[model samples]
Target: MKILVVDDEEDVKSLFEQKFRKEIRNAQFEFSFAFSGEEALTYLADHPSEVVMILSDINMPGMSGIELLKSIRKDYPAAPPQVMMITAYGDSQNHNQAMQLGADDFLTKPVNFIELKEKLLKTL
Candidate 1:
């Protein structure tokens, strides 16, 4: 499965790389990273059908995850890729907005990879 992960934090690339090392090595999961929502959008334009899921951070510097989710839903309304929004704050407002925007799932920051893996499995 191919998953595109978007976050402003550069270290997120390394974190996911390390956490999913076994899956990557075994070719069970392939991940791509984007440091901003615009970057993620550019990537989507290049590989529209490649990504199976998107894991995005809600509090990005530009183009928040909610905006990205809205765009994705609008652009791919037929069968959009599953989106899972992540945020450091577990506030109800963000959660509610993400759901209202059509997020498939929501996750809090300091993410638990085990839980994330389980969720990913179900999503796939």
Candidate 2:
């Protein structure tokens, strides 16, 4: 599966790379990235078919994950990528907003690798 990870943190990217590089090397998966929501949308516009899933950080500089999700649902309605919103905050408001904006899942920050793995596996 091809997965896009949208986050502002370099460390987060490195973490994901650490966990999935073997899968990528073995041809089990491919990884892509975007530092901001706008960048994520641009990548999607150019490679829509190549993207199957999106794991996005909620707090971004310009556009937030919820905004990104709404845009994806609006412009790519037919085959919108499955979005998993990740945030440091675990409040009900964010969770509701994410779901209402069309996120397929919501994951709180300090993310558990095991839970994330299960979620990705199920979605894939």
Candidate 3:
């Protein structure tokens, strides 16, 4: 499955790559990384319907993840990619906002890769 990961942290790409190395090598999962929400939108526009899921961080320099979720939900209302929000803040406000904006799932950082993997598998 193709998954897009959006975060401002440059190291996140390496972290996810390292954590999912086995799945990636086995061709079970393919990942694409975007450092900002704008970049993510550009990628999606360039490759429509290619990404199956998105793992996004709520806080960023430019457009916030919530705004991204809103855009995705609006632009692809009929068949939007499954979105899972990831943030260091695990507050009710963020969670509620994400759910209200059509996020499929919510995860807190220091993300548990094991849990994320399980959830990803279930989507298949």
Candidate 4:
């Protein structure tokens, strides 16, 4: 699976890389990183249809993940790639908005990799 992970914090790249090292090495997964919502959009635009899933942080400096999700759901209306929002808040409002905006799933911050892996397995 090819996944794009978007976050303002650069460390998220290393964290995901480390967490999914085994899958990556086994050629079961591929990953790309975007440091912000804008960057993620640019990447998606440039690579159209390459990414199968996106894991995005909700609160970023420029565009929030909810905004990003809305854009993605609009632009890729047919067979849209799955999007999962991750946030520190874990509030009901955020979760409801994301689902309403067509988010495929939601995860709270300090993500539990084991659960994430299980979710990925079920979906992918």
TM-score of each: 0.96, 0.94, 0.98, 0.97
Query: Judged by lDDT against the true structure, how good is candidate 3?
Result: 0.95
Candidate with top TM-score is 3
Candidate 2 residue runs with Cα over 4 Å from true position: none
lDDT of candidate 3 over 1-124, digit per residue (tens):
9999999999999999999999999999999999999999999999899999999999999899999999999888776899999999999999999999889999998999999999999997
lDDT of 1: 0.92
* Candidate number with the higher lDDT (2 or 3): 3
Cα lDDT tens digits for candidate 2, 47-118 = 977899999999999998889998988999887778899999999999999998888888998899888877
Report, for every candidate in turn, its global Cα lDDT versus the true structure.
0.92, 0.88, 0.95, 0.93
Query: Which clashing pairs does model 4 show?
Result: none
Q: After superposition, how far is residue 93 of candidate 2 from its true place, in Å?
A: 0.5
Candidate 4 local lDDT, 22-87, one digit each (tens): 999997889999998899999999999999999999999999999999899988887589999999
On the 0 to 100 scale, the lDDT of residue 89 in model 2 is: 94
Q: Which stretches of candidate 1 lie over 4 Å from their true place?
A: none
**Is candidate 1 or 2 superior in TM-score?**
1
Sort the predicted structures by TM-score, highest score first. Answer: 3, 4, 1, 2
